[model samples]
Target chain A: MDRPTNQKAWFLVLPVLLLVAFSAVIPLMTVVNYSVQDTFGNNEFFWAGTAWFEEILHSQRFHEALARNLIFSAIILAIQIPLGIVVALSMPRKGIGVSICLVLMALPLLIPWNVVGTIWQVFGRVDIGLLGHTLEAIGIDYNYVRDPLDAWFTIILMDVWHWTSLVALLCYAGLVSIPEAYYQAARIDGASRWAVFRYIQLPKMNRVLLIAVLLRFMDSFMIYTEPFVVTGGGPGNSTTFLSIDLVKMAVGQFDLGPAAAMSIVYFLVVLLFSWIFYTVMTNFERGGQ
Target chain B: MNFAWMAWTAPTAIFFATIFLILVGMGVWEYARPGGAPRVGILRFETTRGDRLFVSLLGSAFICLAWLGLVGPNLWWALGLSLVYAVLVFRWV
Candidate 1:
């Protein structure tokens, strides 16, 4: 009812349409073109059909990287969602303390991805970095560069540091938007703190948590810069995510057709998973309603 | 106009154009039928017409990919499978 009957609103979408065409559509079409063709040298292309796609699908390298990505995403979701919820819950609801908490929470997110990677890369150096040095001083063996376990730890820690704030901020927004009346009613009913949260808060936070989970899942799944900078997809490909492997294939090896095919596959996988998450969540929400 | 660097070829161009046309057609269909009432199909979850369309398209992509990976590169059979899948999705998804 709020929308105008006139169609003039569509004209406003033109700029965004043009932007998408230039930014996403054209580049994606180029990748699609490359995916189907083999390029030797001198810019000559021959039709390769689904050869590259088949190769990528059959490759153990692709499967391993995909597994690593999925595991990393799962781990981060497990850690960050609960941590974010707790952080949001503990945060003061009002006053200057709220602003302080928000600013502090937002600080890590404001740092660029590559910078976060660099920071973690240096910070996990056993020789010089505070965290690594302290761990070493405490007789803890920690060398991200030398050990796969340490590398995984550093990468996971870095990702959690970089992205947990996003979940927290989103959940905070959800928490604040919850009416005071609900809390008051819960109090009047002599509900426990757990009951208040379980009944009054979690239900209200369902939508925002969906957004957070999807965003976190997608971001962590496609994560490249931080993990790449920190571990360089090592110690020996342990931290090699889909994006890292794609970059290694496309730029490092210059296998254009195979890389492009992998890119398409990766894109489709993300799209499919995101859609599934959205559908399932919305369906669940609908059932609840 | 100057898209030579993108290495546009006849087949690729046609492919993308087909996708574009399908999207435009979908838009037109939606505009014509304003109320896209959600329906519970054989999948047991409620889905609108657009959702069914999306499921069909995404599922078709997977089917084609799986066929390419498992069977030979002769995509004719894959396309046939995709068509049948799409029809089923639209009809009973």
Candidate 2:
């Protein structure tokens, strides 16, 4: 009996590796350089040690942004995970309805980030926008431009709309992958719907749900473009998440040192959380299996 | 020396150019390797009959409304709706 050999898949993966290195790694290195040094005009640099990092760490502004980011990510996870699961559960499992649901769920994921922002920007207007007009007619005082709470609400909603499908789709894939045999077994046992979900569906979904949570958290934490477009971090910095504030400092104010330091901190925080999530998920998988 | 114009346009131009280059590079690499054309079910952007088109449009419309409702009905509702509408037309119709 001959043993099956591992196929060389490096050719398949090399392009992706090169693309990521070029897009993510090189720019990250540039940011690192900017973080640790003081730069004068003409790109001249002087050693500043950890002064920039210290400044950012102690600043009230940084703390506020960090707090906002944490809260946003938490709220998003809380809302999206449950909502996504429910939507996936309700979707038709086969036939024409299945195709319709799948296509609808996937549409939001295809649109570009900035374009999503732009669409929301115009859609939320007081006069011509359907939503604003409807809300106004119903006597809700909602103005994202002037009210911080409204701005925050709008941003959160935008994110949910754009991303919940991703979670739903992943959950659907997990659900569909459960063999019909499992359902048949549950039926033979005369299991209640709750029991079937509790013992079978929930366990199967655990893996994909973990992936969904991590992806959503990371993306939400790094959220910049949509919220930036919608509110411009405006109505007095009320909607300024870490990413928005970072962009403002780095690009808007051109405070390269502080921005770079913030970026490093931001990257590290994401990396740490991701590692923790990965560890917990792998442990859960091993236990379940 | 219009700093404001430079501030906006320069960043926008650079961003677009960078994305274009990345996409082109990826596309070329994919073409050279020629993995069995990406699953047609996922990549199909065109169809002759209008049934799929109608379904796509109606589905997108519902999605847009869902997005609007999720956020708390406001101006963004229009944006979300318009985007879904455009995507339906482009991808299906």
Candidate 3:
């Protein structure tokens, strides 16, 4: 029961293409234009021809920022995925408790990024902050402002607290979609919980899990506001991820050429990784099917 | 519309224009031959022509950037390397 291939349906997509061209294409083109050129002041430019790219590529600063960003994203994915799944699995399947759990999960995600940062900043303070006060009372020294390790820990903790719920909600959606008939069959066969989860639940959740992973990865990689407000890329640059560094270059220093080159490289890195993730996940899905 | 605010130069403009042309050409090719049958090559991943094009482009970017970083900004040899890589990808990947 196949319908006719209507070429006219493409007309519906025209507006979206135009919108994308204006929003994404033009800005990207401008970035590309700046990447290959140098500037001093007064809009005067020189055709630097990948010089900025070379400089940025060879720069230790860029390398460090990129490394930090990668590590942060990796840590986030590692913690959030399993934790989210566990939380989702433990969530009530029926009754008023489901609504309560969903609202709780949604609460963290609903907070603005800057507000989340502010909340954590005050919450981690030694004098007034409950977390800092508790740590001090326990005789464990915890100061995000002075200690690099503590700063990193706080940022990671903040991210986990904020974003884990998104993964939980997605996984919960996947979990709830499982037909009761499957569970009945499993029960009749006296299948263990582990077997049921592995054979049915895990497989069913793969698609949503993939989405959760990609979203979390991209968001964490591009993260700026929360970390910026909390650590300001300090405890001596331990927390200065790529986005913060890019802002420092572009706005703070007015080094547009190098910044643009770095931006292009950064965008490419994200695109390449996301593409790889998509390909691998889709291949896995095909295998599962 | 006056476009001097963007400060576009000839070489960068040409580079972008060339990329645009290539993309347009790829679109035309796709329209001409509707089904880009996915083929498993030496890479052992099932990839269509568009996927190969994307891989080639992404790989070429890294190659050019690496060459520029390691060697120097003189990109002629890098361009040659990229073209060879693209050819190999189209042929085998």
Candidate 4:
């Protein structure tokens, strides 16, 4: 008996590849072109070599933004991973309540980035917004628009609300995928809930958790639209992450060369971290039983 | 900001409209598609009830418009509502 292998799967993937290439690849080439060249007013260009990259590397502004990006990503990952796992664990395995929870969790994820910013923008306003009004009524001097600490708090909280659900959903999927047999075995052995989770659930969820971490890290690092909408990279430069800084360079300042260099650097950092995540996760998986 | 708006007028409006239509069209298509209730994932842990589909769609639309009202005018609200309606369809229907 001969077995049939289908190569037609490539056809299904072709459209997605082309779409990504057009959206991602072509613009990247344009950035590369701009990075090494300088243009005078009338569609004229002169090669600037590595001057732009050198300048960006030496710039304190770039360093500050990079530092902030790193810190934000770290903080988000620190908070969201454990919180998402806990939420997923608490959620009902199967019931009408499960559906409601899933839908509610998904609500924030579905909202557009710009809109999420706007929603929080209103939501944190001291005038008519619920959070701000309640906080003030409770005697808290919270004004995000005027205060740097408040701005940072609001931005971080907004991100947590927006993205924690994604981590939860991914963790939920990982949790659900564990076979009932594992639970049966654990039950037979009279294992505590924590023990079963620690031994069986944790190991099984490792793969998806790795994915969740990498995704959250990259997205948080590159976040622009939400923070931009919320803070406009103000009261000062306190909330300006690398992506916001890059946008300011590219569009606000129209310094194409430096912006391009910054983007390339940003892309590399994300790629490098993602690779590290993949390698570590795969190694762990291989080493496990 | 006004200068930026002036520069962005044609392209922004067009892009916004295009997104709106695409979302609404997708939502309608999903609503029209026949399925065995709406299963979430490979494990099929949760499924949307048929009536909840309509409620979900309406709620998403309302939320989208509310967002637009905060940051935009009528056109943006319309566009956002449609897009959110589409997301509901894609997610639930």
Candidate 5:
């Protein structure tokens, strides 16, 4: 498993390094520039120091958006992870059904984000949409456009439909990778299904589950397009998660300085959470080992 | 079952077409240059060119989505971010 220390490997890395630099580093630098400087029309900018950053940090708007984002992510993780695990467990482990099931499960993940939003938007309309019409027929008031709870329900459902497959797929891969010998040992021990899963399967799937959780958390935290397209962050800013609020600031209102500062803070928060998740998970893994 | 309304405007169609073409081109490239001996990057696992391609493409799509959602409909920033994502995927993923 020891790799030879070959400097020539840098040649292999050069292409990717250049590509990342061109894309990520440059724009990030621009954000940094905007964060510290004040800009007027005609591209004129003046030094603003940390005024924008301080303002954004102290702003109630930012706090509300951040709170919404945290709550949404928490809800998504709670629902998706357990639901995905259950789905993965129930999926056919052997036979042609396996491939068919996997492909069907993966369909949602491949749809473009905007397209998903559009689909949900149309699907949730009270008049034309099936669910909305059915709910109304059943004597349940269901209007995502007007009701904040309904809007949240629709958005959460849309996310669950779009992303649960990812968690399921990851867990399925982990499940499939479990060695047959482990199952055989469990059988020899006359272990119950729950016992087998708890001790053998769950432990085996830990790494992939961590990946699924981390991905879901970060993605749900940064989510914007699907909800935006569906709700426009409306019903009175009720659904305005941090990304949506950030977009409104940077794009809608053209508040560059504060937006840039907020962007930096947002990026840092995401990085911090991801780092914490990774560190804690990896530490737990090492401790178990 | 009518599908005609799904037709995209010229710019959107062209952009998506180009992405599809690039993915096809990558497939062709892979066929031409077979197994890219797996190498370790930032992650502990060794990845081949195909894995790198998957990561880059997915990452690029995310970059574009985030850009459109957060920075406005203007795509120049998204393209820049995607290019960086592709490089990072190749370099590290």
Candidate 6:
């Protein structure tokens, strides 16, 4: 459906632009300003072009954090995408069950990020937490605070529980939007379930699935609060993802220059991935058309 | 669970209650009017009232969360960001 060309739409967009400018653009510019200049108390700054960026690029800490971030995002995508699709497939497609499932699934997504972290943090404590006590009772020594592997496991599980519903919800919407006539045709042709899913449901869900992947990837890549609260990037820096490391630099140590540069790099990486995903998905969407 | 409400401070309780109220208000509105059919926005496609509400609420939540995470505990920033987000959702999304 082609919308009428209307220049007046700029009026509608102006407010958002102003909002983004104040909220995102200004703060980003401050980071950029800090990235290029060195400051030593009393509001004094010296020009140090690209030095901070160079330092960040060469830092072992930055490399480790970046690697951890990439690995975490990859693992999250690997698990969540297929799992979400399967969950969506199993969900009831009709009646009150649909609404109930949707609402229940949406519950986690509605919780504040820090609250999610806190919940998991308490829940994973070895002494009092249910998960910790249960694991201990079963004779598995599970201590997220003390063990690197345990921390990773807890963080990943928490993320999967929190976010899989988003992917499932998007897929469910896609699945429901599929016309009934398509299923009728498939039944008449005696298509197998896998055959039907592959040709009909999968193809139909492509757009929404792409959206789910992009959203999940970007979010997991930038995740901070939950993991920070859960492990505080502890157990020997094992959970120190890029965002946490950046925060430690920017906030903890007040190393503005490197932190600003790191923030820019992080932003660029997310932007690059999102762009790549968008391009690839749109290409596929166009090809299908 | 008996004293679950006791665990919450006044502000947290109020914040959560407000969110609940907004959701309940939306439910009532939807039931009363019964029309959330898609309409063209700034996006090149049609979106329903439910879509707009979801976008607004989710975006606002993120804004609020990010504000708390990145900035200090000031809610003024969150409120300002939410207003902008709501306008954008109603206008474009």
Q: Using lDDT as the measure, which candidate wins? A: 3
Off by over 4 Å in 3: A1-4
lDDT string, candidate 3, A118-202, tens digits: 9999999999999988998999999999999999999999999999999999999999999999999999999999999998899
Best by TM-score: 3
- What is the per-residue lDDT of model 5 for residues A100-208, given as tens digits with 9 covering 90 to 100? 9999999999999999999999999999998899889999999999999999999999999999999999999999999899999999999999998888888888899
B15-93: candidate 5 lDDT, tens digit per residue: 5568679878876775566556478677665567876776676566556545644555566877888888888888776
The DockQ assigned to candidate 1 is 0.57
Please give the range of 10 consecutive residues that has the lowest summed lDDT in model 2 chain A: A1-10
> Which is the better candidate, 3 or 4, if ranked by DockQ?
3
* TM-score of every candidate's chain A: 0.95, 0.92, 0.97, 0.92, 0.95, 0.95
* lDDT, candidate 3, B1-93, per-residue tens: 976766787887898898899999987886776667579998777999989999999999999888888898888998999999999999998
Q: What ranges in model 5 sit over 4 Å off?
A: A1-5, B1-93
Go through the candidates in order and give the C-alpha RMSD of each one to the true structure: 2.0, 18.3, 1.8, 17.5, 12.8, 14.7
Residue ranges of candidate 4 with Cα displaced over 4 Å: A1-17, B1-93
Which has the higher DockQ value, candidate number 1 or candidate number 6?
1
lDDT, model 3: 0.92
Point out the higher-scoring one by lDDT: 1 or 2: 1
Q: For residues A1-289, what per-residue lDDT tens digits would candidate 1 score against the true structure?
A: 1323777888999999999989998899999999989887677888887889999999999999999988888899999999999999999997999999999999998999899989999999988899899999999999999899999999988888888888999999999999989989998999999999988788788899999989998998899899888888998888889999999988988899999999999999999989978888877777766
lDDT of 6 at A221: 99
lDDT by residue for model 4 (A1-289), tens: 2222564775899999899968996576566666666765454556775567667766889889899889989999999999999998988988899999999999999999999999999999999989889999999999999998999899999999999999999999999999999999999999999999889999999999999998998899889999999999888998998998998888888887778877877776776677566656765775665
Q: TM-score each candidate.
A: 0.95, 0.71, 0.96, 0.71, 0.74, 0.73
Better of 4 and 6 by TM-score: 6
Residue pairs in steric clash, candidate 3?
Answer: none
Give the number of the best model, judged by DockQ: 1
- For residues A130-218, write the lDDT of model 6, one tens digit per residue: 99989999999999999999999999999999999999988888999999999999999999999989888888889998999899999
